[model samples]
Target: MKKFDVLTPIGLVVGVVMLIFGIVTNGGITGFFSFIDPASLLIVLGGVIAGLLINFPVKDMKHIFTVIKQGFSQNEQNLDQLIKTFVTLSERARREGLLALEVEIEKVKDPFIRKGVLLAVDGIEPDMINDIMSAEITAMEERHRKGRNILEKAGEYAPAWGMIGTLIGLVLMLKNLNDPSSLGPNMAVALLTTLYGTLFANLVCLPLASKLALKTDQEVFLKQIIIEGVIGVQAGQNPKLLEEKLSAFLSSKERQKAAELITSGEALNDEA
Candidate 1:
């Protein structure tokens, strides 16, 4: 919670820096302003935004709001800790009564995961647990899908917007056909907006959509492991078996750490 992590928008920062360097290295800074095209910028922005709203619903737009904010969010949602903690909780609940986990659940920062755990420990049947958790999963997926769609829509829109920008510039240029001296600068502004649009679509929006999609899949998988572990815990399996089962959620490095923890604990027990 203390101020840390990468909050700066890397895409915007890198773009600005490269633009500045290119301007200086090519023809100098004045050349940049000499070719500035406000109309081109407006076309790209307005067209993209209009296109996105056309493609997705208002609800989806709400999801996109969160995705946009997450672009600047610095907190790295670490899953390794969540896996380790949940497994430890499952094992503890087996050794002690389910009520023993009440305190731990209170401490969980993730409300949904914690709620699922509590529901299981309260002796909900496996089927009922699945129904509740599955509903939650469906809702989460819907929410996530909307955000991804918005980003994808933005990606699709950007290039078309660029083309539109170029067309508008070209039309104006052609209208002044006798002014050959005006053609080069007009074309540069026209083409630059297209370049900006295409690059933004391909290099930025598409990549972000892919990243968000991957993150959504990963989190869903993690929650799936949680669902299984919670159901397993509710059924009251052997704590060691429960630990082994939940360990599947962790990466290989985490799997190794879990193994060492179990081994060291066993060794201490043997010595005692």
Candidate 2:
């Protein structure tokens, strides 16, 4: 299945709705247009970017767009289906030997799972397999941490920049206090910078960071399942026992499907 995510669009719609509703309630369309202060925008956004660039390396900044995309993407791991497949592979390996898994390896879609199974079929020592696979998992986690930290820093820095903009605006407004007309526009820039900062931090950066964290948990869980299942296969575990062991990874609803699949012998049938 495709892993497209809906969070990005949903969050954007909600934010836009909030801005529009707040503006329309205040002074209709005029208030909405009045909020468009280019100087305020530049101060908030540009300052935030500049702050981030200083805080993090340029290479990390280069992947900001990619990291944001990943935040919105789904992990696409179906636990019930995965458990069933593992059960099937274990039974085949037990009956016909690990070499029998060679054909099945080609059908496996996830590269991480495929690599683990390939190592098992190749007769790699269980300890060696564990070492290699565990290293990969560690590296995956570190990469995820880096991406999350970037967003987190953005969340942290946004408000700081916003405050800077507010101060800048305040200074400009106070300097032109004699001109009453300039007061309103200058004050608007100050307040708008704060609003932009708050919106970006709460509505975008922080939320994306949280979402990426949740996604990392899911991907890590799926990868753990693969690592465990492959090691069980290498150990020549009984298929039924392996199924029972792997079922621990599933939720209550998924556990029911797992039980039915094992009972009906449908999981083993897939190997036929």
TM-score on alpha carbons, each prediction: 0.81, 0.93
RMSD of each: 5.1, 2.5
Q: Identify the runs in model 1 with alpha carbons over 4 angstroms from their true place.
A: 1-8, 74-80, 259-272
- Summarize candidate 1's per-residue lDDT along 1-272 as a digit string, tens digits: 21232423676578767877887778787867754677667777788888877777776676676786554443344444554555566667777878887876776666666788789768888899988998888898887777777878889888888987788778878987899998886787679779778877877788777766776776677678778867776777775677677777677887776666655443111110
- Model 1 residue 268 CA deviation in Å: 22
* Candidate 1: residue 79 Cα off by (Å): 4.7
The residue pairs found clashing in candidate 1 are: none
